[model samples]
Target: MSDHAVSGVPGGPVRESRDVADLMRWFGDAWVLPLLVGGTSLVIGILLIVWPNVTVTAVAVLFGVYLLIYGVFRLIESFAADEAGGTARVLLALLGVLSIVVGVLCLRNILQTVVLLALLLGLFWLVGGIIQVVAAILQRSRPHRGLTMVSGVLAVLAGVVVLSYPGISLLVLTVFLGIWLVVYGVLMILGAFRLRAAGRRSVEVTGGAAAAPAG
Candidate 1:
C-alpha cells in the first residue's frame, strides 16, 4: 500500500497530477506554511539567545515547545506535498514523529540528567538534519533546493557539535543553538520566497492548461 497523499483544493476533487496548484490557488498563498515555520523558528531562536538568566529547565521547556510546533508543521508539509515523492514524504513524516517524541520527552523530563537532555536534543537535530538533506535532494523539482540543503547541513553540523561536546555549559550550548537557529531561520525565509516564485509559475502553468482548446 502506498502512503501517497494527493493535493487539491479544499472541498474539491483530489488531483493525481503533481503539477496541480489547487492548494496554491485556493489557499491564496502556497508559501504560507514555509513562512510560518521560518518565522516561528526565528522568533524562538532569538528568544533562547538573548533572554537573561536562562535556566536549564527553561531551556528544556522552550526547546520542547519548539520541537512540538516544528514537528506539527513538518507533518503537515509531508502529507500535503503532492509534488513530493513517497520516500521523501516518509522521511519527512519520520522526522516529524521523532521531533514530537523528543519534544514530549523533554517536556516530561523523563531523563533528569543534564547529559541525557543534551544527548536527546543532539540526536533529534542530527537525525532531523539528515532527513531534511535527503528529502531536499529527492525533491529535485522543488525551488530553492540548495537553500534547503544548506539548512539541513547547518542543522547536521549543529547536532554534531552538540553531541561531540555534550558536557558543554548552559551558556555555551545556548549561544551555539541560538546562532544556528538564526542562520537556519534566515535560510528558511529565503526558501519561502523562492516557494512563492514557484507558486507564481504554477499559476501560469495552470492558466495555460485551462486556456488550451478541448480536443
Candidate 2:
C-alpha cells in the first residue's frame, strides 16, 4: 500500500500531518529563502532608482509590496527553531503585523501614507541614532568609538532633515528609499550566506557525532 494508505491504516495520519507541518515550518530556515528575498529587494531597489520619475502612486504601491514581502520574511525568520527565542518571536510577529498594516494603509492612501511613513522613518532614525550614540559613549575605549559617534550624529542629522522637510520632492524620497533598500538587500544576502555556512557546520558536527562509536 502507499504511504498515505499505510498512515491511514494505523491512525498514523495525525502524526504524518504533524510531520508535514513541521517540515513546512522548517523549510524557511534554508539559506536559499533569504537569498531569494534579498534578490527581490535588490530588483525592487534598482527599479526605483532607475525610474525615479515613476508616479507617486506607483512608488507607494511598490513600497507596500516591499513591506508585505519583508513582513512575510520576518514571520518566516521568527519560526526558525535555531534562531529566535519566544520573546524575539513575539516581537518579530508584532513587527510583521505592523509592517502589513502600514503596507496596506500605504496602498490605500498614497500621498498621506508616504508622508506619514517619512515621519515615522525619521522618528525611528532619531531614536536609533540616540541609542547608538549612548552605546558608543559607553564604549568610549573602543578604537572605533569616534566613528560610531560620527555615524550616530549623521543619522540624527538625517532624521532631523527628513522631519524638517516632510514635504520633500518625490524624486529625492525615492532616491533615499532606493539606496536604503539596496543596502538592506545586500546585507540580507550576506546574512544568508552566513546562515548557510552555519548550517553546513551544524550538519558536519551532527554527522561526525552520528558516525562516532559510542560505548
Candidate 3:
C-alpha cells in the first residue's frame, strides 16, 4: 500500500501531493532509523558533556553499544537489500566486526582515555582544511573559492588553538560543542514542530474534504 495520498486542501479542488521529500532530503528514506539513532546519540553526547566525569565511562560504553548494534544492523540489512552485492555484504560484515572490536577496546581503555580527543579532532580539521585549500587551488575556476578559503582558514585556526593548548582545549572544546548542540537541538525541535503542524493541517484538510457535501 502507498504511504501517502494526494487529496484536495480544505480551500479548493487543488490536489495536494503528500511528499515524503523532507524525510528523503534529511536522510534517504532507508536511513531514517539510523538518523533517529544518531539523533539519540547526540542527546546522549550533550548529557555526557554536562557531566563529563560521570559520563566519560558511560559515553564510551554507549558508543560501544551503539556501534555494535549499528554494525549488526548493517550486516543484516546488507543481506536483505538487493542493491547490496557480495562486496557490499563483505564490507558490512567487516564493519560490524570492526565496530564491535572498537567498542570493546573503548570500554577497556576508558580509564586511560585522555581528554586529547579535541586535539585529534583539530588535527583532522587541519588536514581537511589543507585538502580544501589544495582543491580550491586546483579548481580556481569555481565560484566557491571564497567560501572554501574561509573554511580552510577557520579549520586551520581551530586546529592551531587545540594543538597549542591541548590542556585548555578540553574546556574550550566542550563549550564550543555545547553551543553547537544548543543550536542543533533548537533547529531539530523547530523542524519537528513544523512537521507536526503540516501533518495536522493535512489531517484537517482531509477531514474537511470528507465532510463536504457531494456535488
| Winning model by lDDT | 1
lDDT (Cα) of model 2: 0.64
TM-score of each: 0.84, 0.68, 0.40
Ranking by lDDT: 1, 2, 3
Q: Model 1 over residues 1-215: C-alpha lDDT tens digits? A: 22222223533323423235565564337577778778877887898889835777777887788789879988987887667889999988998999899989889957666677788888888889999999999988888789989988888888898899978777777777677777877887888888888878777777666555444
Clashing pairs in 1: none
Residue pairs with colliding backbones in model 2 are none
How well does model 1 score by local distance difference test?
A: 0.78
1-215, model 3: which lDDT tens digit per residue? 22222234433333331233333233223333434444654675576567554443554555456556545654654464333345544544554555566556546654343364554445544654565455445444333345445555665676676677666533455555444333333443443444345445555666565456545
Q: In model 2, what is the error at residue 189, expressed in angstroms?
A: 0.4
Which runs of model 2 end up more than 4 angstroms from their true locations? Answer: 1-29, 81-83, 110-114, 120-161
Highest TM-score, which number? Answer: 1
User: What's the lDDT for all of these models?
Assistant: 0.78, 0.64, 0.48
Model 2 per-residue lDDT tens digits across residues 9-98: 654754545554445434425778778877887888899899898777787788778778877875765565333346555555655565
Models sorted by TM-score, best on top: 1, 2, 3
> Candidate 3: misplaced stretches above 4 Å?
1-36, 52-55, 115-215
